[model samples]
Target: MVSKVKIYVSGRGQFAVQVAEALVEARHHVVGVASPRLRDGHSDESQAMSWDRLRAWAYPRNITWTDSSELRAHHIAADVDIILAAHSHAFIGRRTRARARVATIGYHPSLLPLHRGRDAIRWTIRDGDKVTGGTVYHLTEHTDGGPIAAQEHVLVPPGSTAQSLWREHLAPLGIRLLLRVVDDLAGGRRIEVPQDEELATWEPSMDSPPLFKPELIALPGSVSVDSSKWALHGQEGRDHSRPGSTA
Candidate 1:
């Protein structure tokens, strides 16, 4: 039987919204959302878009929300069962994470230890790796180096671009894995598998110039997904990775 789990979700974009929606659909209590500020229309394109999507979804549903800055400063609810970081750019401070009843977790779209950076999808395409995967891992001080809770692999088909790969495989794959882990946690399963440091790999930031030639890009005026190395769902940072950084 699945117990009602109280959750605090922090992140940006449609991915984060979907995660929140999935949890609620599963009958979980979503205590609050920490998203980028929408009112400050003076932010970057990505932040602005994130705020818009998050605001539109959260407001109508009456989900309590605060800007990421406030989230970093305050204590998370004492009753929160989990803290889920999805495609978030801001870091959820340790004090906040400590309040979760179970654990704080985040999603990354690579077979971690392999692609431990902001732009795993782009790097995977550049490296030409035939197999890559998604991981739902515990949040730690290390970037994407936390112990694994659950992971599943996805194949990179021929002629796969970062955009196609995410749309066709990684995005949905992340949602599936994340929900599965949430279910496991609610069922009293302890699924922490420490990653092997020896096998770990780190790619350069998404800001770096692309090594892959003629990179497939989104058409102008279309909903932008992958631009240069930037991913549609994640933002770049030292303490974070795709779908976003750890809590």
Candidate 2:
């Protein structure tokens, strides 16, 4: 078992909120959230204060909230262990990462360095990938490319879509992988796997839809898809127009 640690979280809502809940469940102190009002690409209207909803979901847990933008003004924590981020779209420059007690890790939905950018789940489903999964990795300057600390595989069923898969599968596994990584970091053991260059892939911002790729998707059975979406920020939110990239 690892010693208890003080954690300064970033972002709010599902990804950030769930990770905070899991950390507390694992017996760690969630010192405060570097709560960002906006999730990367969302409009200001959709990014209002959400501590109320967060409290509803995590009522019994004693937690604090701080503006993520004001991170420099706070008192430094004693034994600030590691960082857990997913849709935490704030800038965690090397300065903050270097100050932590453990790894400043992030979670990605696809096996990297393949599908290395956002919209991974969407891309996998669109590309007719029968398999895709989750990974927890150390955060570097790049997006999802980093030392993979731990990963778990998930099978993409035939005819899967981002919306359906997230509701059923991805979200749940994301939380589990986060807990495992937190535990491993707390225990001072980093069992990581470097990404394979040969298998590495990147998602361009303008790629066509999975349904757009008839060869890979239609070979077995053509699965019709809806590739239209409004812009949604936050590292890994589902994009119907495109699958989301990871944090």
The prediction achieving the highest lDDT against the true structure is 1
Evaluate candidate 1 by giving its C-alpha RMSD to the native, one decimal. 9.3
- Give the runs in model 2 whose Cα sits over 4 Å from its true position: 38-64, 69-78, 205-247
| True-structure lDDT of candidate 2 | 0.60
Off by over 4 Å in 1: 39-50, 73-75, 208-239, 243-247
Which residue pairs in candidate 1 have backbone atoms (N, alpha carbon, C) closer than 3 angstroms, thus clashing?
87-243
Q: Model 1: what TM-score?
A: 0.80
lDDT of each: 0.72, 0.60
Per-model TM-score, in order, reads: 0.80, 0.72
Model 1, 1-247: lDDT tens digits are: 9788998888776777788888889988888888777633456545534354665578777888877656753547777889888876666666777888898898888988787766888888888999998898998766677899989998899998887887778878878888899999999986999987767776645664432211122212223344466534322222344432211
For all predictions, the C-alpha RMSD in Å is 9.3, 8.2
